[model samples]
Target: MKKIVSVAVSAALALSLAACSSKEKASSDKESSKDPVTISFASWTLGTEKEQNLERLMIKAFEEKNPDIKVKIDESISTSDWNGTLSAAASGGKMPDVFALPQIPLALSNNWLMDITKMTEKDKDFAKISKAVRDSATYNGKVYAVPYAQHFLGYFVNKDLFNDANLDYPEYGPSLQEFTDAVKKVTNINKGIAGLNNPFSISDWYPAAANKDMGWYTYKDGQYSLDSKEFIKGVNLAKEFATNGYTYETLTDEQKANFKGENPEEVWLQGGVAVKWDGTWAAPQDASFDWDFIGIPGGRTVVTNDFVGISKSSKHPEEAYKFAKWMSFGKEGFMKRMKIADEKGKMMNTLPVSTDKDVLDEFFSIQDVPGIRTAYDNLDNAIVEPVKIIPGYVDARFEGQTGVKAGDNENATVGQLMDSFVKGDLKVEDYAKQLDQMADQKTKEAMDSLNK
Candidate 1:
């Protein structure tokens, strides 16, 4: 028998959904046509203490609405382990009925989750959903999941830092040269500070380095396309940042410690860093500093979907679907989450996956964040983050990119990295060949699974 219990969202407990809810379950005698069911989900954003509390409260509200259904949400810590967990769950019989999936077509092609094409066809709001997001979730003409939010990449500037340097704040969208000049004008390494420190790590840089349309990474045929011209440009920019002292390619232990001690954004907040390129979520406020946002140069915006899908092994597939739908589209579920996050001083960070006019207005107005609004306004030019969808492809790509750690080639330029990859220096195929090959392999993998 499945376990039945209640724990408060406030009580100290394991971060996983296995913990009980504290909210009082609504007393309802009316029984559903089916037995009670547990729908599990893993939250990618539930890492911080604030996120944990918010996640629990929102989940409890969902349970209260649907008295007949019990929802169990687990917060996964290691993003690296998340895919493995989902794959293992699918292979075993314990996969959560409702869970998160990358909002990429390659991921949807894995065939381990529920399909949402019919739902899309029936919902009038589907017309409002962004084509980029829908296309990212659709594979072979079938929509497999619902996206919860959309995120974009941009430069989060420190208003104080710019002011201290006597530099004018950037407008809505600035060119690469303009951005670089700002970084140079404000940077001062002798003061144990920088104009900006965009993470040199793979996760932080790849999206911006990708093509403005297809992104830096794409797995289409059976290969990869990390060496495209757009990708090279991104790399060059990264190289320039390091060489120009805007970023630290290699931080000493002491420097790293110093960086940790001074919140980089606080550094900007206090007139240290001039700009920080990252997701829309990194804004930090200060009484002494003024800050504003601008779109990244080249009109580049990397939009990714945080999505929900039903597991094939789910015992309550219908209930799971309903819960996932509620989480994405249901009132007081997703919209409430955006409001709560914003009120808590977090970025009302994510753009709604739905096209609800009211929800968009509510979210954007609530936060008044610039980079996010810019992305939404220019979503027509946004491209999905390139991710490999063949079950193990992400792992492979992660290995390859991460193995070539940032700044490993201090003497080499970003152009060199691209040229090396382009010339098959890494034994990866040429750009076009790689994309076509990966796409073919993905198609074959999806077909192979059906025959099984």
Candidate 2:
């Protein structure tokens, strides 16, 4: 659930990919032929105390397991600053041996990644992963990424808040109308608790609504159906929540800042928001006021998680490959990392990506039991966020979404558009029209580029 947009693009929401410059190729020389091979890794998580600690433990286990490779860590202090750091690293010939992906196509095109198809074939852990997930990260028959974690947005209920309001518990996959009805029951913004926040990010309700109305993005003849009745219906429902002050759209800037932190789980500690619309990462437990998460009522699951790729500039490709395999799918290393997560009660932040029944069974056993059960139920019919969505047309109407392209500005971004629509500055019908026009043009452009 991280923003994947280009850093050059405004820091909107996630959707971008890029690669290292030629400078990367010049640094293939080894430190010394006699010295133990060293592989450097980079992580956005290197900034957080909890994540950095977890990473150190994982690396420690990996080192102990191999006993031959020494790891160097280059961390980005903030995910917001990650784009600049990554671009600078590639341009400066300092790309790490293993790093998580912010963008996909650019990395694959510029040879920023190593093809790990052979490794996946031989690794039993990969065999446990889903084909859809593996294929989503593939380009030209090569496996460039190993998706390590994935998640979707859902309704996290503060049971006490709901019970106090006399609202019934949400069904696992409630329909848009059903969730809306539930929100109405609990939302009393005058009292200081929002009925809900954005489903995943600011204005993410559009996609969540689309997911609820249709099991996938509305595409007709290869064009996104932004103006479709279902889309309009979804947007209207979100607007209804805003109008009644049942949603985070009603929150003040300071309130928003508190909930938008790196560790937003702290919001639960206060215990006033009855129904918080957030992703899997934010709802990993029930300790804060007897809470639990459920999939978007009647919505198709959308997974956008972290991925690891090996840098082409690596002098030790095999060692880098070994590290990538160990982190993502190697049974011993992966489980050790999972055990650390369990010990520290950080399963939500460090969920496993493997689809292997045995590994997952073991993973579920150690992590949040109730949360994992809900997750398993939700992922049964999940779909990864398609590249053709936000990533496909950052230059067109989605500009503010991926950040400002040369001709784009904030007023026209997906986030801004939704904000206006929700605030009544723009009409839902008009917003739908704007989206439809962009969808048609971008869809054609995407097709043309693909054919080329």
Candidate 3:
């Protein structure tokens, strides 16, 4: 009886051991099925609601197609505060898997980005991307970033208004005053037409032949001068533009209401305004007006979207590469993204930076939109706006440093400081002096950071 009980216990133990081995083998096989990866991405911003939505949808689609990978988004750093945010992340040694490179060269030199040249070469979509875009992402003989889009900002004008006023359309070359005078002459609000659309205010939109030389930024070398006599002329030109009923603040309550909605640029599309200064992307495709655009007066600045780079800190570098490639190289994936914007009835304003024959074919397949060809032409002298392009410069801007109460009214702020002189509350010389002081302060701050 004792032997029989011991044998029975041993048999049960063997059965339990067999069950454990099978469970372990099944777990190992599941783990080996596919390597799972989760990557974190950061950018200054995804921009408008449509843009934010587009990213979410794109990520969802990517994950659906590639189930082994997942993406986490971190957009807490506004472009205005991107430099500081990135610095803090670096200090914590917890940088994102992918991020923006506002200072591309600085990031590359610091080993913050990884070289993805081999992966890019292997990707089918990379083969179709535009050389200009691919070149921007290349650093030190290696591809460190992914070029997404090219954008252009300038003036979109109503051809009918120019014709009605017997004024020649603003094209290649025109003095700032020439443009302002034309806007004034065309203004006849009683006739239900505004000579210009200054919905956002009247600062950089005023084209100054002088700005062609100033180039918007005060780089470290300091060869350019905001206090230069030429620059003052440009600032005064902006003031004159406001004085001539060219600003949106001068519009009636009824006219103002037309632009209160989210997409106010549509007011121009309705044929109520003759001139609007905005990014070329604001121009809608289905507008029923006769419109054309000219590059911003200086034509020196070119607008491009922030580039995507892989973080050196990324543990899943290959997976991060796959993420970047999926977004850029996979045409169908991107086309799916564009479809979201299309459904939202928004102008993408960004042209594809890929020369891939199929992608270009897909891009142009959409009915040709106006101002796009012109925006491309403007890219000939592509450059950057110091205040808009560079991250820290805004904190140093006149109005940005000093709040609205400094010299602004409730109606507008973009040109309100300049408007103060136009309204005779201030002197042009004082305005110029104020600008000089601001520029000097900014330069000093920039210099200190560089020395550090």
Candidate 4:
């Protein structure tokens, strides 16, 4: 009878311990549920005071809406060393939850990005983003990043210089010939005023301007036509501009000696250059004279975009996605950003990727630069700068993937071939075919590597 009593007491003790353990787990889970998740965000743009403040304001607004999530700004990453910094972070398993993408191909190759296709598909606002912008972040039919901001590649005209020359300001979309003629008319070698700056980017702009369907370097159908007639024409035009007095690069030694300013290189800012090939973000904030922006010769232009992505190593992906959307294409976030800019009486340097009417309306109201609206309107026809998307583009263009040397210089790369042509050391017709072949082969190799 005593033995039976002992067994009953032991069973009772086991039951009590099990119940206590279950209750403890339930209490711990409740506490964990209430704990806010914090995600880290890093951006090179945060190096600037104005941009940092703007981002902080946006973050504050985001936090107000998302009380369960917190964003911590990671300032250790910087513009000059962003790539190296990110590489180190990725290797150490300490990659920020969200960060700006300095190179999309690098990010994709390293598997740094998370597959956010599902999140984007479920997001109604994402559909409102421009197709080209969306396509820029997509690789192999998968979305890995989002275009956070963009700047249009075009001409920034000095109105004062145009009026002084008695020449009408070039309209928004001038033909190549019209643009060339205007450049000639505006140039006054005797006065040290150049019609255009050294148009090094003629090769980039000419083909696109000449052919509406072609992108930079005549990229189409996943191949480059660097040796095409259109490309040769662009190269010849660049050579012609340099040979003539229209561009600063071809100016005579005498002309340089007789330049009108203490710093002849400062001609653009001194209002001595009629039109400068540059990006919209380079627009002068407080100029001594009036200025306006216009698209490059053709109706089509190039756009440089900065992208953002959620890190694959992020522990809180859902929260990270919410923050990334708010800072990128989300309409509500854009509205709040515009509100902040308006209140501060400052203009945003980056253009919105969203096509939402309300977002655009707010953005345009705050960005009242001359001809800016028309420039924005032309985005429908613009091509994104290729190096950001095309695999091995940087290698083919800059890193000597072609193994072709310039002239007899065994160490020279395919990129230097253009400079040689412009300088009259190499003939465009002599090497166009070779360059086309090299570009195609290198690009194919890159694509194949990616597939593998």
Candidate 5:
């Protein structure tokens, strides 16, 4: 009986211990489940303390909405070295969960971007984004990045200068002829004020301006149309303005020396130039005189976008996608960002990519810059800037892509050829065909290498 009792007691004690272990495991798991998953985010735009603080607020707002996730901001990356840093991180299998993309083609080619096509397709809010922005993020029929902000390149007109020249302020959508005429009328070499600061930007603006169907840098249908008549027109137009005394570039050395400002480079700020070819972000806030922004000479404008993408190496891809969306085109996030900006009495530098009515209303309410709203209202007709989107553009443009003879050399890059053409050493009609072929071939080579 004693042995029996001892055995029974031992068995009961063992069962009790097992039950306690089970209970402890259940409790531990419950506690662990409450721990939030952490993800990392990086951006070159957040270099300044104020910008980082704003990003922190954005992160805070995001955390409030997503208590189950935590974000870690990586501030070590900067614009100059982001590509190299990302390349190293990717090779090490330690890329940040989400980060800004400087070049979509580079990210895509290196497999740094997580495929977000399904997420984007199912996202109702994403569907509300502008087509131009959506197209910019898509590559090879797949979405890789989300547009964070868009900066429109347009004319910043000094209204006072226009008045001084006795010319009416050009409207939102001025024709090329009208633009040319305004430049002529506003020019007064005697007063040391040129009509347009420089016509160099016309090279960037004219392709789309001349033909709304063409993309910036003469990109269209996955090919470059550098030889298109529209491109030739734009190049010739730039030459016309540059050679004439209408532009600051063509001003005589004596004229520059006699300019009103101590710094002739500051002519635009001194209200000496009538129409300054610049981006929407360049709109001055504390100008001594009135100014307004308008679209490029043609109906279309060049819109450059900043993008954010999730890393392919991310462990928490879904979570990273959520954060990326929040940082980019998510309507709710934009509303929160606007609220934060308003509370801080700060102005947003770039426009929201969201096309949702509520988001636009919120953005316009806080954006008080003159003529900016009008310019943004016409974003439907805007063209995407090519350098950010086109693969190998930097190489094909700056570095020599073809061995074709150009400008007293056996090989020349498109930039070199353009330099020769603009300086009147080469004719566009003679070299447009070769430029088109070279640009297309270089782009194809880049794409082929990426595929391999």
Candidate 6:
């Protein structure tokens, strides 16, 4: 009887052990079958409700396609907070899997982003990207990110105002005189309208021509060129807008009161102003009003592409990279994004920077808005804004430095501001010397980082 009981207990123990092993195998297989993990994305912002919803939808679509991965996007950051946010994340080793990267050589050289040059070369679609956009992202010999869309610097004209003033719609590239004359024809203050206007205000002029505000960044040689002849002319034109009463200026208390509605796109839409120089992003947002646009005169029409980059600290680098490529390179993915913008009927001012000839031609062919056609027509002369081309160039030299208000007198001379900055009169260098120094600093900073 004792032998029988012992044998029975041993048999039961063996059965239990076998069951446990089978269950463990099943669990391991399930774990292996599951997709890897999540990634984080950060960008400058998504200001409007429509934009926020569009972003969420796009993210959802991406996740749906990439079921194995999840993306957590943080869009609640102001421009002031962006640098600190990225820096803190980097220091903590908890940076987003992908983030909006700085577009210039200096910020990129800091080594916070994954090198995307190889990816661009390896991917066939890389050939389809805009050269200017790619060049802006390239540091040394490598490209670090893919730019998504083109944001052009152009003038939005109220067609009705132009007609009322017996003026033609602005040409692709008008002369400076032509621009001024056109503005004068359209000015009608009693009707609460101006000839032309932007929020550039007194101190806002210098940066408008050279800073991130205008997208005119570039570097060459060892110095920067914010005070270049071309740049100076640009600022001079801005000042002209003030001096000629084409822009908002406060000569007296009453004038200051009139300058209150500087950004009233509605006013511009309703023909309150003859023109407003804004990004392509403005067109879609002003659907209720009919409008047209022309490229700024004499200067190369500039555009800034929104750059998409991967974070070096991401846990799921491969997936993050794949997602960036999908968003930036895949036809289906990008088209879906464009479709979303089209659906909202907001500013479809963004154009594709893809190397695809079909995409480019189609982009031009689809004239959903008058501004779209005008921009497309002006493409041959298009150049990315100087600020977009050169990173950090805007902040270092142009920010609040040398516009109409730089001299502090409302009636201060534009030439004095230019001479002061270009000549380094405030103690930087002679005007010619200042330009050379800026170009050199920018070039060295960009190339050195890339080589590293």
Q: Against the true structure, candidate 6 has what lDDT?
A: 0.59
Off by over 4 Å in 4: 1-33, 48-52, 76-78, 249-253, 260-265, 345-347, 401-409
lDDT, candidates in the order shown? 0.58, 0.63, 0.61, 0.80, 0.79, 0.59
**Per-prediction TM-score, please?**
0.69, 0.76, 0.67, 0.87, 0.88, 0.72
Q: Which candidate order results from sorting by TM-score in descending order?
A: 5, 4, 2, 6, 1, 3
Taking the tens digit of each residue's C-alpha lDDT, what string does model 4 give over 26-80?
9988977886899999997664555557777788889999988998988767667
Name the weakest run of 10 consecutive residues (lDDT summed) in model 2: 12-21
TM-score quality measure for candidate 3? 0.67
lDDT for position 96 in model 5: 90
Among the numbered candidates, top lDDT falls to 4
Give the per-residue lDDT digits (tens) of candidate 6, residues 277-396. Answer: 777776634445456666665535566677767776667777887777666655666677677667765444356666476665555555555555555545544556555446435544
- Ranking the candidates on lDDT from highest down gives 4, 5, 2, 3, 6, 1
Model 5 TM-score is: 0.88
The better candidate by lDDT, 2 or 6, is 2
Task: Give the per-residue lDDT digits (tens) of candidate 3, residues 324-351.
Answer: 7666556776676567667866445456
RMSD of each: 13.3, 16.4, 9.8, 6.9, 5.9, 9.0
lDDT of 1 by residue, 218-320 (tens): 4333344554554445545555565455664334555544442355545455555666666655555443566666656556556756777776567776677
- What lDDT tens digits, residue by residue, belong to model 2 across residues 187-301? 6655556667543232333454455333334543255666777766666666776665666646566555534333334544476566776667765354547777665655455
Q: Is 2 or 4 the stronger prediction by TM-score?
A: 4
Error of 4 at 424 (Å): 2.6
lDDT of 2: 0.63
